[model samples]
Each structure stands twice: as C-alpha cells, then as structure tokens.
Target: MKQFVFLIDTGNETSEHKIHATGMTDALKRVQDLKNHLNDNSNSDLKIKFKGIIYENAF
Candidate 1:
C-alpha cells in the first residue's frame, strides 16, 4: 500500500494548515472537490491551496 499526506493551507492573515493522509486513489482525487466545497461555504477573504501529496515509504 502507498500513503499520501495532503497539506492544506488557508492562506490568510493568520495562516493555518491541516494534514490528511490516505491510501485510496479515489480519496486522493476527492481532495480538490472537498476543498472547493469548503471554499464556497466560507465567507473568509482567503483562498486555500491544496498542496500536492507526499509519498512516504516504498510499497
């Protein structure tokens, strides 16, 4: 199995980030959709960057 870490940053005056990890191919692609959904709901004047995944260890 492979692993991935998604570093999400909501660029703002107060920069914040969260990490999510998964091994599923479908889940990895869903990050973009989820991020978009979140952006639409938030009233914040900021945009979040969906940083690419980081592979950890060999299969």
Candidate 2:
C-alpha cells in the first residue's frame, strides 16, 4: 500500500488527511468520497478546496 496525504482547504482553515491505498486510482476515489460526504453534511456556504496531494513512499 501507499500513503496519500491530502491537503484540504476550507477557506477558513486547512486540514491534512493521510490515506492508505493500493494506488493513485484508489487514493483519488477515497478523496472524492470524503469530499462528497463533507459536502452532503456541511453547511451550504462552506466551500471545499483541494490544495494538493502528496504521494508518499510505499509502506
């Protein structure tokens, strides 16, 4: 598995999430799922921005 570090910018603040996945495709899917969940549950005015992704060494 590989580690993917996602940098999420919410306008007000930024958050980091580390995800373990088989590859880039899996990592992207996971990130999309998280964005969808956040969008569905958060206030309408809240905007989610994806700053960047860091592909880490395999573990």
Candidate 3:
C-alpha cells in the first residue's frame, strides 16, 4: 500500500485527502466515500469533484 493524495474540489472549497490504497481506483473510491459523507452531513450545496491525484507514494 501507498499514500495517495487526492485533491477534492468542492467548488467553494478545496480539501486534500491522504489515503492508503493499492491503486488509483481504490483512491478514487475513497474520494467518493468522502463525498458521500459530506453530502449526508451537510446542507451546504456542495459541488464535489475529483480534481486529481496530487501525489502518490507520499510515504
């Protein structure tokens, strides 16, 4: 496993998610999970998007 940094662009704000996964697909799934959590917990009308994979194998 490796550390992957996913750049999540929420239209109004940007956040970084550092996840441990074996590949890009796994990292992407993590991002989606985060998005779901945010949507379920907030009413801020977030426009969530997967910006890009910023870094891989960070540590």
Best by TM-score: 2
Q: Highest lDDT: which candidate? A: 2
Off by over 4 Å in 3: 45-59
Question: lDDT by residue for model 2 over 1-59, one digit each (tens)?
Answer: 56777777666677888778877799889988988887787654444444445556625
Regions of candidate 2 where Cα sits further than 4 Å from its true position:
44-59
Q: CA lDDT, every prediction?
A: 0.54, 0.71, 0.70
lDDT of 1 by residue, 6-39 (tens): 5555554534343445644655566667677767
Model 2 lDDT vs. the true structure? 0.71
TM-score of each: 0.39, 0.70, 0.60
**Between the candidate structures 1 and 3, which one is better when assessed by TM-score?**
3
